[model samples]
Target: MKIKDFPHAGETPPFGAGGSGVGLYIHIPFCKQACHYCDFHFSTSLKKKNELVDALCQEMILRKDEIPGPLQTIYFGGGTPSLLEAEELAQIFKTIDSHFEVNPDAEITLEANPDDLTEAKLKMLAASRINRLSIGVQSFFEEDLKLMNRAHNAIEAVTCLELAKNYFDNISIDLIYGMPDMSDARWQENLDKTLALDIPHISSYALTVEPNTALQKFIEKGVVKPVDDAVAQGHFEILIERMQQAGFENYEFSNFGKPGYYSQNNTAYWTGKSYLGIGPSAHSYDGETRSWNVNSNPKYIKAIQSGELPIERETLSVTDKYNEYVMTGLRTIWGISLIKIEESFGLKFKEYALQQAQKHIEEHLLFLDQDRIVVTQKGKFLSDGLASDLFLINLS
Candidate 1:
């Protein structure tokens, strides 16, 4: 199932209407090479790297008052943030410091590819105050890597993890299951490497071929075999069982972590906390309105240089907010809080949610627990579908 296919799920507001504890997301839209499955905005060529960086800093300065005091998390996600030199990272951080009040213990994460995490780079990262690393080790097998057109090979994947663990204890690695050629054994081997690495957190997703992506074309032309939904479901079940056995909490649909190791940045998003997303194609939400920067690099840089925000805005309706609450809340271990629904969206919305969830509860897909609607183990793999099924269609 497509993760982004949830009906009625869009720009969701935070827990309370005016909630303020904020997170900062910096989108570095440059990758060394494009992955077949990736649809996120990015550029393969870094011809305007300096100008883009300057634009990012300017955006931060321009939008400093978007969110209130004490930024709780700072996430650097993108084509490959690890590609940036240490000095560049520091320059961006310096800009953020000048404009925002970053908590001393805030979670600062950099999304890095396996090949870029060299020994010297790790040391520089450790010194740069980036306390966490989210490595894109999509698979531990060479075959899978080649199929996805990843920049790093299987050997580099393993080697980098070994090196990264020494410098940073708070690390998360991403792995993909449900590839066209992935067998049960290969899926197990990927998990085996993950567990062997003693990594505290893991985020895994089923391989989805988005429209216009290479994988989609390959399947259309019969160049590559199509992914099996049943097989993907099986892989997910295996992942849940294995992670539970290893003492990791399935905090969110695709994330498993050892208690405190949960991704604070992502959790903020799932829990509906306000955040300021900077750079190209980045999204930002403050309680009532959600906005996004221009997706094109040249347009975004030009707009920023011209002293315009280069963003689009959407003011969420009350119905829209409640629908979002149902969508994001059900995807996490925290589930949907009935009290929150009643308090934030009103009793009518809460009653509507309960009425809609009745069928799923009877089907054993979802259950009520101390006022929270939670997905049962049997329904975890189908959470997105189930959530959409429970969404309120009326916005009035």
Candidate 2:
């Protein structure tokens, strides 16, 4: 059936005819090795890598104009996209530029492992149009790296940042807090090292053990201790305070950045900008509809080769739209804009949200800016629960 026959969700105003623009996410599902805690789609075998890259290019060409807005941002996220040689990555970007009307100033970000980056590699990336690099520097401690089974050691993680600064001004690094063994002093050391770097963006994630990962299995077998809530909470406090002291803004729950160094593509996604996703396990949204490619390498390749897109989509319901806005909005530093919230969900929602805010405000977990309802530091931990309380439950 045509998208118009789906529902009246996007038919409402502020959400546009189908809503705000789109962003393209390309997943390069190849990795030299897997981290014990990761559950993302990736394989360690290099046998099919060359073919996979070709398939990815073909996938991009196959859905060149699938979404709208000409494509403002293109993100190369992955198991470790930096594992590929610069020429290979360039070939894929070339395909995108040829087919998608990518803006001249579009943010082209590549996710890389610290081990994969070097001065030579950085120079090659700089020569290409790739403007940003999001490095996987999970921890700056050797013991933590060992526990996480990360590919790079503590020394390599630090060195990569030094090398990366020579090539890219817009750089983002991922740091994982809340490890069972990561002490406050150790955590402080990691934060100090990260702040010393000249990079702009930082994505500090709380470690979560998802189902079926090796970490979970190890804990199940009693080979490792599970995460400690008290320890995690302590480290979280350290992260917030330390980053704030370093002059970084907590732009999102897991993201912090120096002034103007925010990830344009990711910010667009959170603020409801649209983008196409290509390759295996990639997700795409055209504002009204949400779609994602198949997670299997062979299956994704086969579908693209056979002139079919390996994807499934869902038309957004009014309820889905409201819940989505609530989910994404409440996690940012900007918080929920009461004015926009009213315009988008209606006066009833704004009232209920304010009512919910009152309880948090009394606890000092929330506050009101001139026009926005911003969550305080204490509220960030229970953000999901708080957001759920404000959700438009009966907005069918």
Candidate 3:
């Protein structure tokens, strides 16, 4: 059955209107092959696909009471959400419809790889309730794809976008920069191609070698060159320049979008809205507490089948909340609100935040716009570090 047959399928809700509505994140932790630099929890084998899907649905039903409000956004993130068959997707959608109050114009998104977006699959997805597609293109060059061991080749990358654009209007593609031997010129060409395709939203990130990953071993063995922070910084500058000229706002550190195409699901997260995360290795956040399910497929399935939740929870302290706000706020175009710090936190917290920000302001890496502490263009690349400097280690 198609998702349009469901009651909540209709025109999209007004952009930025559902800031208070809840979000749902369904994690499909299965992949055909593992990327070299990846560290997310997932299995290369689909031996438990059917069981996992059932467990996902069960988890939704088990935790339905956690979310009392209508869902404004539902995201299918993964190891590869596109790997699910049409029937499997339909089953999950049916469960969501039965248990949750989904807004008629909810922003439903599914993340897909370029190779998975064959014409038939695109047609199937377009007919479903998924109104947005986040394609994992990574790069438009063969060498880069091979280095990262992405499932799709450069040809499939471009071809999928060509076909997907026909069926999906709200599309976002991922692009990686700062790889070894990725020259500034080559990075520019990648951006040029993305703009040429007229994709609405783009999420780009620098390549980092995570500990215990294949990338780290490769670098240790000298099979791959180490990642250079200076090189990454230069490429980021180029990215900021190119996307701005294309009229795409760098709304968040790694995300860029046109006027009306920002990701509502992610925006909700940055603004501290609560979301329910389902499936193995998924995390859920309420306004004050954070929780995550067990990160093992077999274990997660076993627990759910037994009517138990294999989960862990943590409650945020006032210091924890203030620190999180500073971290997420600085990474976005919204910056940190001094008034929010005082109101949500306390007067002491606001005084400490301003005190910490003075150094960045004097160095011209940050500035005060009215009452907001905003990062300057020169400071954008170092936003994370800047935010850390502003973090309160102990508020006792």
Q: Local distance difference test, per candidate? A: 0.87, 0.79, 0.90
Worst 10 residues of 1 by lDDT: 1-10
Top candidate, metric TM-score: 3
Candidate 2, residues 1-396: lDDT per residue as tens digits? 222221211222222112234577889898888898999999888788888888888887877767666666778898888887877977887887788776666777899999889888888888987889999998988889999999999889989999988888999999898887788999898888888886688888888898999999988998878888778778888888888788787767788878777777767766677778888989887668888889999898888778888888999876677778778877776677777778887887778778878888778676666556666777887777878877776753
Q: Supply the TM-score for candidate 2.
A: 0.91
Candidate 1 lDDT, tens digit per residue, 1-396? 222322222333233212345899999999999999999999999998889999999999999988776888899999789989877898999998898998767888999999999999999999997999999999999989999999999999999999998899999999999998798888988998899999999999999989999999999999999989999999999999899899898878999989678888878889888899999999998879999998999999999999999999999988878878778888887688888889998888888888988999899888776577887788999999998887777744
> Candidate 1, which segments miss by more than 4 Å at Cα?
1-20
> How many residue pairs clash in each candidate at the backbone level?
1, 6, 0
Candidate 3 lDDT, 14-104, residue by residue in tens: 2243445899999999999999999988899999999999999999999999995999999999999999998999999999999999988
TM-score of 1: 0.94
Task: Give me the candidate number with maximum lDDT.
Answer: 3
Descending-TM-score candidate ranking: 3, 1, 2
- Tell how far residue 130 is off in model 1, in angstroms: 0.2
User: What's the best-to-worst order under lDDT?
Assistant: 3, 1, 2
Clashing pairs in 2: 21-274, 22-274, 22-275, 23-274, 23-275, 23-276
**Local lDDT at 164 for model 1:** 92
Off by over 4 Å in 2: 1-21
Instruction: Report clash pairs, candidate 3.
Output: none
